[model samples]
Each structure stands twice: as C-alpha cells, then as structure tokens.
Target: MSALPNNPPPNVSKDAVARSLAEAHRLTDPEITMIFRIEKPGQESNPAEPVKLLEVNPNTTASGIMPVKLMPHAPSGIFFPSVIVEVHPTELEDLKNGNLLLPNGWKVNYDRPL
Candidate 1:
C-alpha cells in the first residue's frame, strides 16, 4: 500500500498500517474499495485514527462521485485532508474536484496509486 508523506502520522506503526488496511477492506469489496487516511475533525489529536473505507461506484462516470461510510450519518460535503490509495483513470478529474469530503481539518494529503 502507498500513502502520502507523513500520512499515517509518525506515530502510526507498520502493524497499524497492516491492520488498518485489513479492517478497511473487510467492510467492502477489495476490488472496488478505496482506502484513505482521514484527519480527525474536532479537538481530538489522534492522527493515527480516521482511516475511511469507501466503495466506488462502477457506474460513476455519470455521477462522478464516490461514497465513504463513516458511522450512521452520510454527507458528501464534509471536506478534510485525506489520502486515497487508488483512483480510476477516468475518475481522476472527479476526485480532484476538491469537494471530496473527510472529517474537519482534513484535506487531500495525496492521490497516489494503490
């Protein structure tokens, strides 16, 4: 797996990366799922947490959007810093809209390949 510079945070250990990726993929299909490192929104200071597991729509060409599941609530407008492991070639433009949401205090850390 790949990540942005200082992405998982200096405190994030190698074991955490393995466990995080395993847990992230457990919730969705690995073939279509995207892994991300999201910054915590509030006063919380744990940067090692907040990895998001998102499912990519195979028919996203028309919609040009991907959904990330966090808790019970769903909103596409919460912008924050994040690192996306993989992105489809066709969806790069859509992913770059800069509107892709994460928690607060988060922004795109990197848009690298898986």
Candidate 2:
C-alpha cells in the first residue's frame, strides 16, 4: 500500500496512534485544545479512508465546513477514514448541551477529549 496517512496493513497500534494524536494537543494547547478521530465507515484498504480529526480549541473560529489539513497520521492496518471536526471550546460545550450539531456522520471517536 502507498504510505498514506490512514492506510491499512497494521504497521502501528491504535494506542500508539492515539498517543501520537494526543501529542498534537500538547504542541498546540492542552487545556483549551482537544483532538480526536471520527471514522467514516468504508472499505479498509482501497481508496484509503480519509483521516478525520475533531479538534476543539478556543483559538479557532467556529464554522460548518469540514476543512482538510495536511496533518500527520501514523500508519495502521485497521485504520479508518477519519472525519475531523474543528470547533471552539464553547462550540464543543454547545454541542454537548444540544445547542450545536455535529456534521452528519461525524461522531466523536471515544466520546472523550483527546
């Protein structure tokens, strides 16, 4: 398989991948920054699932669009096509409080902050 971000072949562990992603929050900001994966169900290999990340930070402006970013993704076999959502902390709370809605098909991976 080509060395793509979310490609399969089982080269890395999910825990390791989560750890790597968790590091991103550290690099940016831990308290107000949150990151996690939202997988789009699809075939495991062909066409490579898009890497979806839901990033909630106080620094970013809230929007309805799911924008793509050139972020890093660790290699894995059982990887998924991720749907990342970036939102402000208030937005996240609003989502939890039923004031905001997550883009359709995009759900929080672990249901927790990363």
Candidate 3:
C-alpha cells in the first residue's frame, strides 16, 4: 500500500503554515482567554461574552501574543476566523481590570481554566 502524503496543499501561504502550526500547539498545549465582542462606536449593549482556550506562543514575532479562535457570538454551529493578540496571563488581574485589545478590534480578557 502507498503511504498518504503528509505535506500541506501547494497553495498554502507562509502565514497559513505558521497559523496551522500554532493551531496544532493550541490543540495540545493550550491556553485560555476571555473573548469580548468589541462594541461599535455609539452602540448599545454588547453581545455574548465567551471564554475561549487558545495556544500560548512565547516566541511570536509579536511579543506576548497568542492565537485565539473567535467563535460566533450567537448560538450556532458556524465557525469564525482567529484573532491574534497579546494575552494577559494573569486571570485574576484581567478579570479585575480588562484585557488587551486584539488586531481584530476586539478585547481578550483573562486566561480561562481548561
């Protein structure tokens, strides 16, 4: 029997490869963060606040940042892309104060329990 190919598809970019690796890390050695929907300017109440477990990346080009998969705010089976940002590892402090702003304009607040 022939062995299956293990390499990624030919159309993948470097960023995609890096993200894939990061996602692998997230699956195994994972970290958690509180995700908040960034309220739009002049908007009213925000949406649901969900806590997500992500991967801890210590040596990213962007220092002190991690990858977080942003799930849909509403109750559904749809999936969303990820947002990378600096994560405050201290859960208590983050809970007390707030989290760092993400590249996607949202905020990530604490390291949640697994």
Candidate 4:
C-alpha cells in the first residue's frame, strides 16, 4: 500500500481518480462489477482525504490474497491519492455474506458504489 502523503489538501477528487483508474488501467477482461469507497478503521476520513476502495471484478484472479494498488493519478495530473483493492466475485460475496472481513481493520462504511 502506498501511503498517501499527509502534507496538503488532496487535489484529486475521488470522481477524477475513478475515471482515471478505469482509463489508465484499461480494465477490460475482468471489468469492474462493483466499486465502493472504504473507511479505514480507527480514523475519521472526510471526502477530501485519500480514498480506499474495494473493486469487484469477476475475471480477476482469486489468488486468496487480494492485490492492493496505490495510485497517484499522475497521468491525470497527479495529486490523486488512493488505494484500490481488487476483489474477486466470490470474495466480495463472502464479504457481503459475512464470511470474510477486510484485513487490518478496514471497514465498509460507504456502501454507495463509486
């Protein structure tokens, strides 16, 4: 996980980062089925803060360990700070079904898809 710099107010909006992520990564085969922002446990996070997201993709390999990605959104003018976690369909279902929990105390507060 790339630590988002705690220096300045985030210049990249979640919306912008979302768009850039899809575009820059060109997620095709395993297209994103769902997306939602996550609230890291033990802290208060406003919309202006860096985001952590869970993205569900059916074709994404379910290696048991979900891959975490950090984006600076440099291609979209930088300043975007966020973590993107790729989850397989089954993993997402497990989470929704209460069979799994986000590691390291991360919580799902925003059910609204991004």
The sequence of per-residue lDDT tens digits that candidate 4 reaches over residues 21-105 is: 6554445534777776666655534443456677777888776546365645454553546666778889887777878787667
- C-alpha-based local distance difference test score of model 2: 0.56
Backbone clashes in each candidate structure, one number apiece?
Answer: 5, 8, 1, 0
Candidate 1 structure quality by residue, lDDT tens digits, 35-88: 444334552244434344333434334443343433211132212223333445
Candidate 1 stretches with Cα past 4 Å from truth are 1-19, 22-28, 40-44, 47-49, 53-92, 99-103, 111-114
Q: TM-scores for all candidates?
A: 0.36, 0.57, 0.26, 0.65
Candidate 2's residue-wise lDDT over 1-114, tens digit each?
Answer: 333455444665444555555575567666546676665445323334455567777777876545554434434332533444677877777766777765545555656555
Angstrom error at residue 42, model 4: 5.1
Whole-model lDDT per candidate: 0.39, 0.56, 0.35, 0.62
Reference-based lDDT, residue 72, model 1: 15
Model 3, residue 106: C-alpha shift (Å): 1.8
How high a TM-score does candidate 1 get?
A: 0.36
* Pairs in steric clash, model 1: 80-106, 80-107, 81-106, 81-107, 82-107
Best-matching candidate per lDDT: 4
Clashing pairs in 4: none
Deviation from native of the Cα of residue 87 in model 1, angstroms? 9.2
List ranges where model 4 is wrong by over 4 Å: 6-30, 41-50, 74-80
